[model samples]
Target: MGAAVTPHVVDSHHHVWDLSVRDQEWITGEALAPIRRDFSLTDLLPEARAAGVTATVLVQTVTVAEETPEFLALAADSDLVAGVVGWTDLTRPDAADALARLRQLPGGQHLVGIRHQVQGEPDPQWLLRPDVRRGLAAVGAAGLAYDLVVLPHQLPACVKAAQDHPELTFVLDHVGKPPVASGAIEPWATAVRMLAGLPNTVCKLSGLVTEAAPKTWTVDGLRPYADTVLEAFGPDRLMFGSDWPVCTLVAPYGEVLDVARQLTGSLSDGERAALFAGTATRVYGLRLSEGS
Candidate 1:
């Protein structure tokens, strides 16, 4: 008898942080208190293994340059983390040089992309800045993807940036963070569809549980937003992500994966496989061996 092939699930988006090393300033307010402490790769492995996730892409939580190298080092040491989407100052004139330097670091080979906290920037068009544009060019030239962690309002600029840099693949994290709590989909859906219209764009099926109405959110509540992206980007252009400790605010890790499965229940086996693994592998250029 032949051996059965294990399902290969890839968590395309998630984060890890040490609170003692640096505070996650964004983790303010009573609601976010649950996740104020440290979260590490060690903390994630068991749950990830239980969820049948063979590999994962650890993403940046802060804009600190030091954090990228740290994440790369972690990737180098870990078997499960195949890639890292770290942060680098896109406004720096030496952005390309910085990327080159990062690639030379111990685990730099695992760096698959760069991301900026566009949602936190006051300027909605921050991505369109000349300096940022130059950095984006450098990233494209480096042959790395750029992850867009933006709010709904910033998606227009996201579209422009994608249009301006057709060479780089722009990954839209968390479905542009739709207004799930309010059940509003107009502007977000319209903007997301526009971004999906670009050939160089991809979307992550993540963070919706946190974006919904606290603990009361249901699979049905997330369906509209999920359906919009599935129809817009299609399963091949979309990837699954747990969003991790942040998602813990609303549901546990297992529940998060279950909800994503339920939301994507209507897809064909191949389509679901693409959403859960293939898309992330192709987009991130993840180095996953059969043993992985």
Candidate 2:
């Protein structure tokens, strides 16, 4: 018999941080205390390898200016990290130059995208800011994708941003953080379809387990939200992300992967391949070698 084919897995979203190096600042409250300590790429390597993840996108955890460069250095040294989605002050007048400088830094070749915590912005339409728009244009000009970490309400602006820059790829993180715990899908579902209508947009099937009631969340609890994105964006535009340590709040890294498998079980092998690796490889312009 032919050897069983091992799926080529690319974890599209995950993060690493070291408290000794810098503070997360966002991991506040008792609920987030479990992950208060340091989480490094060394810690994630085994977990990822065990789960068949050959490559991963190391994402930005905090908005600190230094974090991106640090992450780039880490990615440069590690075979597991194929890409880095780091943060930058989009509102800065020199946003374009800032991106260019980041590219010139050590390990900067691994830099595939840029992200800001739009969820924390006080204004729902924060993406529409003039300076931010210019920064986004610069991102497109740099030939990099943009990762959107926004709440459901902010999706309309994401849609507008994607519409405005057809040349740029906007990856919607965590299915736009749907109200999975509440099981209320209307506004989120509606908004997701609108965002998916734009050809330049892609969605990550991640963070749903944590968004659902942590202890009580089952595969069924996450299906609707997953289904919404799968239907709206299709498998070619959807990718899997472990969400890692943050997902540890609700489910372990392995459990998160299992849940994703269950949610996408019905898809054909090629479709599942797209969700597991192909989409991310294409969207981030990842250059993986044979068997990676």
Candidate 3:
């Protein structure tokens, strides 16, 4: 038999935070208590290495302006982190300037994209807000992608936003956070198909485990949602993300990766390669080491 092929793996989504540096206010309530302490790259590197993760994209946790620079610095210091999806106030008039300033900061080259906690916004159509749309344009002009962290109901606006700015790449985080816990896929599935129809849109296969009933979620429980995105976006536009530390709220890092592997097992080797790493490298413009 031929030797087993090991595809190059890149975790397209994950985060690191130091509580002492600044409070992660969202880490409240009993359900999030397990990850409430500090979670730094120091803690994640070993786990990522064990999972055969060659590189990772450190994403923002809060909207605070200081967080992005900090994450950039962390990326600069770490060999494992290849990119960062930081946050900025998209409502600001000089959002483009802010992006420029960020690019000038230390380790700025690692800033691959930007994201907002759109799921928390009360307005379902928040992405269509004029100011936010303008900022998204700036992101595109800066040659950076935008990560969508919206709920299922908000996907229509996401489609509109992507339609409005064909120049920008819209990366759907957590596959619009499907209602896996309830097992209802109608609206979410339909909306996902709409968004996927747009050429600029891509998706991440992360966070479904948490969206499902945390205590009862199984690989079978997650299959439908995974299949929906797989069929809609295909492997070339879908990337794997651990959403770690947060994923620890349900399954450990390795288990989360294992689930993703099982979900994508039916794909051809080249397709699996794109799902695990190549798509992220292309979408985020990541610069991996020579042999990695």
Candidate 4:
């Protein structure tokens, strides 16, 4: 008899942090108290393996330059981490040079994409700034994708940026972070659809659990948002991401995976496979071994 092929599930987004190394200033409020401690890859591997996740993309948590190298080194040593979406000072003039330096470092081959906390920026058009646009150009020139971690209102800028940098693939994280807790989807939905209209853009079906009402979110509550992205980006351009540690604020890692599975239950086997693995692998250019 022939051997059964294991499904190669890829967790396209997730994060880890160490408190002793640096303080996550954003984790100060009581609402984020539960996850204020160190969350290392050691804490994630067991959960990921149990969820049938063969590989994961470790995303940057802070905008610190030192953090990217640390993440790349970690990816170099781990079999589970297939790629890294690290952060660099995109506003700096040496953005391209910085990217080149990063690619030459240990585990540099795993640096698949770059991201900045555009969500935290006060300016909605931060991505459209002259300096940021230059950085975007550098990102594209370096043959790397840019991960957009922006809020709903900032999606318009994301659309414009994608249009301007057609060479760069803009990955929209958290489906542009919809207002799921309020169950409002007008502006967010409209903006997401516009962003999805760009062929160079992709969306991640992640972080929705935390966006919903704490401790009470259901798959049905997330259906509309998920459906919006699925229909807008299509399964081939949409990928699955756990958004762990942060998602743990609302649901456990296993529960988050189960919710995502339920939300995508109606897709065909091939479509589901694309969402769970194929899309991320293609977008990030992840290198996976046989059976992984």
Candidate 2, run of 10 with poorest lDDT: 1-10
lDDT of 1 by residue, 132-181 (tens): 99999999999999999999999999999999999999999999999999
TM-score of each: 0.97, 0.97, 0.97, 0.97
Measured with C-alpha atoms, the lDDT of residue 174 in candidate 2 is 91
Q: Candidate 1, which segments miss by more than 4 Å at Cα? A: 1-6
lDDT of 4 at 130: 100
lDDT of 3 by residue, 61-170 (tens): 99999999999999999899999999999899999999999999999999999999999999998999999988999999999999999999999999999999999999
lDDT per prediction? 0.93, 0.91, 0.93, 0.92
- Per-candidate clashes, comma-separated: 0, 0, 0, 0
Compare candidates 2 and 3 on TM-score and give the better one.
3
Clashing pairs in 3: none
- Candidate 1 backbone collisions, by pair: none
- Tens digit of lDDT per residue, candidate 4, span 20-126? 99988889888899999999999999998898889999999898999999999999999899999999998999999999999999999999999999999999999
